[model samples]
Target: MKSFKRKAKIYLPLLMVGAVIGLLFTNCSKQGFDAAVAEIQKGDDPFLGYAWHINNTGQSVFATSGSGVVGFDLNMLKAWTSGLSGSGLKIVVSDDGIQDAHEDLKDNFLYGVSINYHLSTPTGANNAPPNSVDDNHGTAVAGLIAAVGGNGVGTKGIAYKSKLIAYNLLSSNVAQLDERIGQQVTGGYDIYNMSWGSSQNNLPVPVAVWGTSLVAGVTNGRAGKGSIYVKSAGNDFIVKCHNSTTTYCVGNANFDPDNNMPYTLMTGALNSMGEVASYSSPGANLWVSSFGGEFGDDYPAMITTDRSGCSAGYAQTLNSGKVEFERGSDGNSKCNYTTTFNGTSAAAPVLAGAIALILEANPNLTWRDVKYILAKTAVQVSPNMSNVTRHPFYNYPGDASKNVRLPTGAIWENAWVTNAAGFKFHNWFGFGRVNVDAAVALARNYSSPYTAGPSVIGFLMNSSPSPNAIPDYDAAGISSTLSVGTSLRIEAVQVQINISHNNIADLGIELISPSGTKSMIVNMRNSLTGIAGFDNDIFLSNAFFHERSNGTWTLKVYDGASNDITGTLNSWGVKIIGTP
Candidate 1:
């Protein structure tokens, strides 16, 4: 569970439980090595059969109560046989400290390159290790990224041979947060996996400095080819509306302002059945999704390396009130592994490992090229999701007089939008779950003109109207348009909004591209329920990827609730970031 904070200052040092994995195929067997590619050696890794994320065949992932859908996997066996195992790449697990001595990770853990921060030394230092029993998230994260393969003891990682490093920035104080960001840049690593995120409330979180750092990483890091940054979309799909409300509310991935940036890949989580993981935060910023599974006891979850012994990690021998899998039983008597590690936290690392394989296939490909490849090859899962609208506080028994009702005929969430570029995108699954084999095949022959350098041309087109009054409880909300003239093959779209409302969560925001593609940027009845309105806050959407940025972009703001709260759209604008 991620620690939630509501403070004036920002501190992102907490763990958020989130969502991927897979191992060997029982029937899809290959004999010996291929002639052209490197030898496909899975070694004697004993638990390979239990890794469904690597190759799914309806296996239960070590749980007896549930089963996964066949063919809902990363499809890595083909890529692995073709010699794309992410060798010679450095991946940084930017979360809690990693157990460098863990048997599955020691061979690949890059010594003296990882950093750990303490109050005594705010600048951070080498020798990163778990600070306490609570600091155990990164070890599981590392195992998912590049736990050593073959040596034959535990489960294998997605990129089993890739170099691994860690940064214990979550344990650092808020005073050194800037130093932590700087450290993220100082390390010349190829990919950074951030499996944690801040709260889901909408209180206008600042991102100017963070965006600057992300730009620096993609522009100057990794010898100018650009380092890839993968982040979790969040895991707060079902949460309390507020401190006082008992009803559960939906958490949008866009609530966290950091996820809206174009420089990082925001990933969502899916279950073993190829469905949206129940807790995955949905939003328009998600680039792709991966299996994060469910709790490992009754349902299938992730299988990864835990703390070395029973008494230290999630799987303890003597632990009481825990499931059989987490208590050193059910073929895990040695207490060396855990099957309950699921979340977007799990999903981010899984995607990171896939990115490592992509880089290995074509190291010359730029970050933008990698993103484009993913967008091109992603597979859309659960294609039947429909448009949804919510009315959380409607006819509240506690305060019926202050009842809330969503405006009629207003869609709070869009089903699936196929842009003019022929790319399909969904808020729950992004472009779709990652297809490792397809992505690798594309990477082998992929090249982008943007590889010379990032020509991320950004232009803002603001609305001419000063302020438009919004109607209360009306589906016909204020509509503003920004006619973009710059010719850019759009990669990401950001909408800067300035509004004043008593309950911003009651406001549903939508962006319509000139190509007639509609994206719900902010869902109604979100975590921002009781807050005032936006003040130049920026919202992002990846649904417009590869579209032409040369037409009118419409922005619609709806007062979805009947709470008698009036608001005004002070000013709004569109900022397009992409290559010309």
Candidate 2:
């Protein structure tokens, strides 16, 4: 089934039962875990005394009792902690900077290894400036992954014992990003979590130089086993705001090129209701979803460590410049913790923590193996109702004169595609919500597909090329085909397109595999109004995961705009990577 145009929503009746049972077991196990954690001495960590997300026992010391409405299912965590707490695994947070000296984080910090790439004389120290506004971001991200657990002080991280290395790349340029990533990979870090990116719909498409660097890192890093890179799918979502009678619109996620990189595990965000977060970006590029909380008073946000001194952090904003604190019976601020961390930023680290657990369970698994296991074991959550509307600036030729109204009904439903091998995939929720327990168990007993022999090694199995003119203002676009004679298990597909146009943002591109699985390479990016067009830019897609590579593959390019600006498809090609 074509992903975008379909209305198939797979609703699992068993999920409701499973959620109920999961909650019951979580509550029952909380008491034991609580007592176990209380025995450890936590110097000043207040939230760990009674955090709802960590304990799930309705005994939170804070004002908001999130109970069951604001936490990742702790059953998985409880099961994971029983056997492992990521004892030896390492995760590097590449962001603004991490407050390594924060009480909750000092224990797990890997000093002398973290680096500040933006510095002229890059140092091992990765702590943010003492009182900088941007310093809290990395601190919050680090706390989510490896803040010390059972300390009786602060909240516990997903993998509280995992070692953390911070790399400050906030002010570094694109070239520096690759350089620092290289350092992490070579430093034996098991996983890297990047929770920041340029705005998804911003103008001027990014070049593929950084993408090439990422490909090289995955191919050569970690002693050739490859380092795991977990990235946050952008938070840009096309929303309509009606002020009185006038309406203002925004951008979509399909244009986020960073998430489209196949080498990284791009994650989206889910709220307390297990639904897509209002700001979480959506597209075929999303690999998975994780709990990152939601907006509004009814839905509690995620709670994590903030910058020291409470000078700049999420809680400060909530309390009107004062640090958010747990109130005692006397109505006085007692323990300090911030419950304002949200967005895909928070979701990425959650997934990174899960990866740390997986690595701790089975460190021998290759990077691809981790991806395979995550795709296999994720819990398929409910569908996210989406509305696909025409770009306001570039309506289809025939519909140019019609008034553009907000789209209604569900235009995109998260549907499952069961491949011949029984592997299920989805464009929206990815394989689904992360299940740490299931993933850990699977990892302990998993075997790599590439371990069999050379026959299973991923290689370029086929290719098709085309250099022709693409039709503008026409639904019937240009197409090029490539034929494969031998059957092969497909792992990834790469498409390269070169074009020249007055306004390249008006273009829409797609690729159809031999099995008729259509992957949308580029949706009309109305936000990119630059006159420059694509020049041999490469786009990657995993939509046809596991499909046999032995048929005619077609690349289609078209411009849906009726405006004076038009473009010609200079050249296009398809490369299928897999084992024969």
Candidate 3:
């Protein structure tokens, strides 16, 4: 029996946490953060609220609808925001509430609701949240998509001139199940972000609100219907995010059933260093990873925001220049800047924000086009970064193997000698990181009939982001640069990111600049690739800013959220082009 247990432990690490039964990952805040707490942002501190700090700022977050935005390095996000200003073209941001009310959000917002959140009863508003208790998730998500542009007081987002919408979903049980079908079919939303999760314990009365609604929405959206669904990577240590309740069919290997719309895109998360987050489930059904903070020794790798008015106000007291962390769950709050997290809830917004930037570049893009560009234009990463890298919060606690980088070629079979750095395509990095340069180049060089922006390969995001800010790269720090009209066109901005498994979308996505300011760009729901396009087409774009400083470009992937997008990627190619 002992031998069997030993073998199970050894082989099961690569599989789902279920194979060996896993514990809940880090408590969302203090896992490996004993070393980086003093660097917390004290609200409104220039360059202080980067991705390492945790502040929800009363916004409706993208993935899984959580609170608090982890802060990033200030300088890093500057590069991310600099490229946002442009003329003739207005950037459009996606939101859950359909109404972005952040202090910095832009005026116009693109609204759309997820099918699941729609009311099933014939006599109801079909509100996504199904309550009057201000589900900040929707507002939080809108804030990430498009906060005020050119606003220097707060953090910056991926796009400057954009709008948002509540895109309501229903959490309460309604009377008519047909309402579910009607909401999905009628809501003319461009992209819908779904950060919530399910395992069956909630016992949803089988209605139009099933997983199929997402597929239908994506199908219609990608087909130029201005409808797409950005789902979160289920927060599970299993194959299909199958927690104790929900059971995913894709894990069955024989999941070859049919559906109305198989066009859903899911996302996952990575750490501050661009590697998969420790708590990040697996790369199985994941799609991409966005910067979720992870900078400085004094702070943890996190995506920061102004969470002063959020539900977990206790954890976000220091946001927007206030002290709130001092309090415990009992209500007493503590005031500090640095914070930590672990889940897909954090990663989804990042990808969504990137897409918003791409949309800014070309307003005529469709959901299908967005998927195409993502998969086809991505950077390759180390092989076992996904399988070998254990979830720091749950696995390898006190185990020496957790910190060790695997030998070259150990992850993939017959890996190239140059791959000694451990870079490859797999669950760890779905086609590697998103190449902002390639994507822009494609938009500039190509003239495809399907897509608009120079045949742009994909959205914003770079390959490598770090060095400017060692250890944790809150925002891109020294890793990236933004050229309004100096280098790349203002309408053309991109970030470095890893499109990993479509899971862990709860982690927040952030952007920081040189001055130490920051912003939450996309939610975990937005980080997934609607399709699995090709990999490597360097011709997308690359810039050499003659008047730019040498900054380390970094893309932090959040570790949260997931959906059937894993299967979606395998079936469809990542497309870029769609208006939210």
- How displaced is residue 336 in candidate 1, in Å? 1.5
Q: Over the stretch 386-412, how does candidate 3's per-residue lDDT look in tens digits? A: 332222222333544323222222221
CA lDDT of every candidate: 0.76, 0.60, 0.33
**Could you estimate the TM-score for every candidate?**
0.89, 0.76, 0.48
Better of 1 and 3 by lDDT: 1
The model with the greatest TM-score is 1
Question: What are the per-model C-alpha RMSD values against the true structure?
Answer: 5.5, 8.8, 16.9
Question: Which TM-score value belongs to model 2?
Answer: 0.76
Native-referenced Cα lDDT, model 2: 0.60
Give candidate 3's total backbone clashes: 202
Model 2 misplaced regions, further than 4 Å: 1-75, 118-120, 126-131, 171-186, 202-216, 239-257, 296-298, 321-336, 383-416, 419-421, 452-479, 485-487, 530-532, 558-566
lDDT of 1 by residue, 435-466 (tens): 99899998998767453343444446464544
Best of the candidates, lDDT: 1
For candidate 2, write residues 1-580 as lDDT tens digits.
0001011211111011112112121122445435534642245555554433443333222323232333344335554446777788888887767777777889998877776655566656654332355346778888888888767666878788998887765532313434454443345468998886655434325545656666666777676777899987766543322121132223334454555566789887766544556566656667778766543233444677777553455444245422235222211233235665667788888889888888888878878888888887877765333324444322423444324322232122224555545555565566678887788888989977765311332232223334466555655666777666667677777777778887775666777778877666665543444546777666666777778878777877766655656666666665666656
The candidate 1 region of ten consecutive residues with least summed lDDT is 28-37
Off by over 4 Å in 1: 1-41, 119-124, 172-176, 242-247, 320-322, 389-405, 449-467
